[model samples]
Target: MTSTKDEISLAGRREWLGLAILALPALLASLELTVTHLALPSIAADLRPSGSELLWIVDIYAFLLAGSLVTMGALGDRIGRRRLLLGGAALYGVASVLAAYSVSPAMLIGTRALMGLAGSTLMPSVVALVASMFKDTRQRGVAIGIVVASVSGGTAIGPLVGGWLLDNFWWGSVFLAGVPVMAALLVAGPRLLPEYRAPGSKRLDPVSALLSMAAILPVVYGLKQIAADGFAWRWTGAIAVGLVLGAVFLRRQRRLADPMVDLALFASRVFSASAIALALAIFVLWGVNYAIAQFLQLAHGLDPLTAGLWTAPSAAGTIAGSLLAPRLAHRFPPGGVIAAGLVLAVAGFAVLTQVGPLGLLVTGSIVISAGLAPTMALATNLMIGAAPAERAGGAAAISATAPQLGGALGIALLGSLITAVYRDQFGHDAELTREALGSAAGADAFTTGFQVSAGVSAVLLLVTAAGAARFLPR
Candidate 1:
């Protein structure tokens, strides 16, 4: 509807290349997260990281990624999306090599955070690229679908691939694996990806960018710390700072010449609700998935490879949901379908608490993922679908931002809560810590920590479900 928005159909070589380039970042981002999770135990042993430190290594990237995305999205609009993508690819490759060589947990986590900066440039560009490449509405839908599918599918596949790598190599090998993939993307990206910039947006806002990071980092860091030490003043201070900064950031954005988040979009109930739903869905799914991975390895005594195999049910369900969402969207509005998916996810988590018998836990995961996958896809579609064409980049950025935040929050808050509950049950026992984390901490401390992580995860899931029903449209 906007004049600056071009109209052309995406087809043939140009369209395919554009979409592939776009999907590459999503794949990389998802891959980075998935591989880290599978490698956590290995990293724990090699680095001898404390239970809290291990959570930080696993949780920090998402927070950085989420925190930086809004600013990066706006930058893409001011600069050129394709130029940003190429630079991001190069940065990702360098970070990958650095990550592979990390001698300590601190180094690896720091490298991962840097990787998040590169990744921040990758996602908004991808969505903006699709909009730039495809002029026709129908073609745009298809392009978005494939791009979305590739990223979502990569997440499902990450554990399987990570499992394979862990079987044969050190945990660092998983980080090393990014090199080839990123190298290929870097080389192909420049030639295949076309440049795009917002026609009218020539200036970028510095204040908003700083505020955005301030608003996000504390909350994310706070949540991560909570996993190791529950209900502490330190955690409370961090969260409060983040929340207050976030409020200030939002206020500044409204008056900015070139704001990262377009406050006006909330007027469209569809857009706002969809964004919230997307975040909530990720919060629930990934949070639980994190616990499930640990349980598979620790309780079931499965190797990373075996854990991946068991998780195939959840992955398959995600794929099934993606495949079915387009059709379901026609019968049920995108919002309604997303809301339904939340209900199903809630049921899945509830079932997890009860499934000690008849593989109840494992069986419940499939049902939960089945519901979540479609919801993820639909929420993504709605976030952009209702936006003004010229603001697609902003809309997509909002969509991505929520999930990044959700992922960090989910792991931090839920992981911590689970650890608290797990520890409470142990009641200051030496063997409990020794048996629980194995080598994560002092005897009594670590067991208490791990259970808190699991319990927090369950409680947050309930909150995520509740949020979906109340804030999202049915």
Candidate 2:
């Protein structure tokens, strides 16, 4: 009884259900990114990982995920998005189980890397599928908003989820949470989701794949090193090599008949501007999130669960802002709306500089998160929209890659600035300088770090706001 038109129509019960299924993988991927931060202490106590090993356990997932996104995205276009999604889901579920049961730190780190590889496939496929599924402009906007919101929401709630699990269960319980979610997605995704692949797509190039990994992994590793051990020559060297490899990757893309990434996509002003704005927006988001978590725990002496609960309002604000963005964009110029959101975030950061009270910090976090969410959502929509229909997977991959790199760079650079300022205040007092300058000086040092970091975050947001207004197309 179903006509061809009825089968392909965008608006339907099946499409909506499929969207919900797609959101699960995106949410789980983002949750895994930050969930480990809360469990590190418990992991350390149980596994007895050295400082360097602990850092590896945390960094490997993101490093591999960011590195593999483009290659996997392009591969999905050559193969099938649905196939890639299901395959990744299976791998992710298996990896989660292994990670949950791992007795050694090395075993855990290896499984986390496998999860990242699986995650790389899931992220791009979900976004590209959303882009392909929603043919209407308005409907697509809302779909993208929902997908983007899940990612941001997951990031916001990751610690809270981890904290609650740690409170009631063992550290391994954090890894097990994803097992059920992945299972549900794997079971339902095939039945509900449509298959998509770029017509006439060429085979993936091995050299470009390796080059892409080489370009991204070192940059992320260098940033992690800067965050953990401060700036070092080796880290700088690693970054330099990454930049050179990145240049090579770009040059290779330009010459290839069937490139892994279509270099010409960046020619669209909307794509380039939106991508940059999204990256900068994420920089502010991740950096401020890290700084605020520290403030809640150290400055206010709140327990992990309590601190996470306090930040929950900020996550709510983000979801509200994302849902509200499409209506605002309809009424105002998109560039202006995005700029206005950044300005609001700047104001939020300004409140943090005052270091008034817990209420003020919470108020600032809500405003900043809410304001930033709209820019991120709209910018992501613009990036995906600007690309050709066939290149949706590659475009989504680039868009996703920007935020991963931005978050790493933001946390490293901004967090280091806060650490340096906190240490400077201690004036070479070794006792006071231990454990992030808060163990000895108590709330005073935490307050200083909070104020300094807020100042930096505010200034960056102001600059980014101006850029968004100037560069993002109305």
Candidate 3:
């Protein structure tokens, strides 16, 4: 039988070492997400990809990663978490090497897809392993904080790292950077991490897994299309079809004796609330952060390296907030702490609305990162903690999935909004500005759109803050 939280001992040196191993994959997954954006121009120039092919090269990784997460998590639970993690790490390293050496866009896209599939296995397994290793409430909180910090920190620093790499070496160097990290994880994981498979877990269901992928891929693809090309009937239809399939998938889960996803877990208010809060927090962070990155470059006329350097402080703030969350939770209620953080994020968004000066933009981003990191860390802990040990992998997948969907939606919807507003500012040259923000006659139109987006983000965060205060457990 699994030990109750009360019966579990505090984590020791071995567990701490294991956590460091697990964090490598977590950090790598996030780094891969953001790092590739910087390399896109280089890839385009070298591979001579058409616009459509280039989009696929940039997006296919996330599409496969998000679509496959739930299935990979369940697979980890049925197999051994350690076994799955190490296997995935090996695959990731091989895929990264393949991606680096690819001569054609098709080859690069295929390798990136492989990397995404391998990435799907890493996060849920890492979170499940961390939960298993650090069973004590307080210790678990800190461990989760560290894991969350790694992800957020990696995202914040991705541009800086990618810029430096692109400056010194070929674009392929970015993909190669992950190879060593995965190698380290593969070497140490078997020795440091414990093996865990859910005891008496049911056989894996192929149909459910298919349904999950079918439901997720279309929706995510549709969102990405909207973000890139603006709204279209085809994309809306894709989302509608995915929603229908998702409903069907849920119905099947309700009837199955050994369902892939445990519906009962969502019955807990804690699980449901944490999931919602985490999603909303990511929604604002990613949507606003995306705009801010563009603002630093297109509006302010800074080069990639300079812009990355300007954004570095936000990365530091994210790490600080993530690490500080557990310590703060000891003194205040978790719900209160979360609400407070959201309020602070709203303030940051408010600052962003002014849309003047580089220092102001940097300050706003730093404040926003500082505020949202705590909410992400604490909510992740609550979501994963609410699950039974055997279901931790699935729980972790769900936790991870929500943020992916949220970030995608934020980028799509907010990006569309920004483009629309910017186009509105230019009557005769709308097409020109819509095609390239930097090529616009002036930065004033883009600035206006950014300000509007920030205001909308602030209002959404304020509402989320109120909900967190009222609903989440103290």
Best by lDDT: 3
lDDT of 1 by residue, 234-316 (tens): 88899899999999998988887667789988788778877776787778667777767766666656688877777765767
Give the worst 10-residue stretch by lDDT in candidate 2: 432-441
lDDT of 2: 0.79
RMSD for each of the candidates: 3.8, 3.2, 3.1
lDDT-best of 1 and 3: 3
- The candidate with the higher lDDT, 2 or 3, is 3
Which 10-residue window in model 3 sums to the lowest lDDT?
A: 433-442
How does residue 349 of candidate 3 score in lDDT?
89
Q: After superposition, which runs of candidate 1 have C-alpha atoms over 4 Å from their true positions?
A: 1-13, 135-138, 428-435, 438-474
TM-score of 2: 0.90
- Sort by TM-score, best first: 3, 2, 1
Q: Global lDDT for candidate 1?
A: 0.72
lDDT of 3 by residue, 139-186 (tens): 989998898888876776777897798888998998988998899998
Clashes of 2: 0
Runs in model 3 deviating more than 4 A are: 1-8, 48-55, 224-232, 422-444
lDDT by residue (328-421, candidate 2, tens digit) is 8888888898999999999999988997588887899889988898887788788887888767767877887787667656765666566666
Query: CA shift at 293, candidate 3, in angstroms?
Result: 3.3
